[model samples]
Target: MDMSETSQPTIDEVDLLLANARLRDELEPYRDESIDTSTGRMNLRTENEYLASMLAWERAPALPIASWFTPVLELPPPDSLDDDSLNELLSATIEKLYSQKVVLRFTDHLSNRELYKIIYRDILPCCEKKVEIPGKFLEWRCFEDTDTWLRYYADAVERRRYQEEHDVRMPPSERPKYRRDLPH
Candidate 1:
């Protein structure tokens, strides 16, 4: 009923305008004849979101996993920690890593010390692209051997196929040594 209310842009309209401006700014440095940003093949919102995510990922810094946290995540020597202390610290550390979007997979086969050592010696020191986008996570597989994966996770048919493909006999399947209920 009021001219002021009709003249003013809604919140969603303002947000859309802001998003379009951001999308244009993000597209500026990446301009090329070959880059197809046309909305004919995709929805404008989806395309804009995709381009924004691409720019975010491209601009993300590569840093050590430990440095991702404030003050850095420092762990005590594996030898100095007793079994109870090690287990508690390991669980807390796993939670902390998950909070930073770092997930440890197929770690049940490893003992607490082994997993902790791997996290400390390998994962903490490793440099990874730190993409701080929502729903983005880095899955670190603790096991490298396909045999371990087959034994622990694969079904009978999958295991049989793997054995046939590799031309090697696989050991009988067994359950994981310790399965922790952690966020995926």
Candidate 2:
């Protein structure tokens, strides 16, 4: 009913309008660029670089959990019978890597370890029977210590090199020469 009360409402309205404008400006980059959202895909390399930069920002950490796990889990399983069995066993081992107590405490719920155990003991063995490779010899080398694991990891690098040499054909003695005198 007074002059101050009327002016207060006007000030509040201006404040709300300013806040809404700020929010809209903040969200401008995420707005739809195309009419068909389903067809729109982000550039993976650019996104990855952007994410790396963001993770390297002062307030954040670069914990690439997905990248670390992808190579190990996404590789094709072995073809031999024993290797096939080992693959099944490895799958089960991965599933049960975190114990029940750890899962319950961390996830705040119970998980079915029985399925994992069954896969390890039963399903894996059946899968192994179909493979042509010697299962017992492979199984003997399956369990290893941290040093052994590192050695195996290094061995994989050699395997990769061998695969690249065998599969990729390159012309001999055609290496490019570097010119170092031009740039400052």
Candidate 3:
């Protein structure tokens, strides 16, 4: 039997299940809290925490999902500033990308052409810089030529992986399971 030929549920189906599970878990907390009269009017911090936890739970798995949903761009920082300033700009850009879940696909062994594509096609046009790297790697005049961009990208990737693992490792009871095929 050719396993490759076997039909499998689409991402939409899995997404539906995930959505249901999220709702179920979110509601469960509210239901449990409703029993306690003293739990009325949740504080801002508490509310924020609850929302954060719920969101984390929901988005933990299937990270880099933004790559699928959002358009990719490659734009670099402005060249008018000195190397130090450029590094700062690059750091800020990396942070913004991480927060926004933008995937920066680059490897340590990236060629100048590859770097240019990432800069011009993905990072530059969308971001402020629009600067291109003339060398194989970003030269670090201050500390070391440690491709800070790649570091940030790796961090984002690792964060997603950790979240995905956490989601999978969560106890079945703690994680809500909903059957999509069932009538609502």
TM-score to native of every candidate shown: 0.75, 0.20, 0.24
Query: Best-fitting candidate, measured by TM-score?
Result: 1
- Model 1, 16-78: lDDT tens per residue? 768877887877787778655565676556767777777777678999999999989999989
RMSD of 1: 5.2
**Per-model tally of clashing residue pairs:** 0, 2, 16
Give per-residue CA lDDT, model 2, range 137-169, as digits (tens): 112122123332333333556545655866743
Model 3: lDDT to the true structure: 0.40
Candidate 1: stretches off by over 4 Å: 1-41, 160-168
Q: Which residue pairs does candidate 2 place in steric collision?
A: 81-131, 81-132
Task: Give the Å shift of residue 64 in candidate 1.
Answer: 0.4
lDDT on C-alpha atoms for all candidate structures: 0.86, 0.33, 0.40
Q: How does model 1 fare in lDDT?
A: 0.86
Candidate 2 positional error at 38, Å: 20
> By TM-score, is 1 or 2 better?
1
Candidate 3 off by > 4 Å? 1-77, 110-117, 124-184
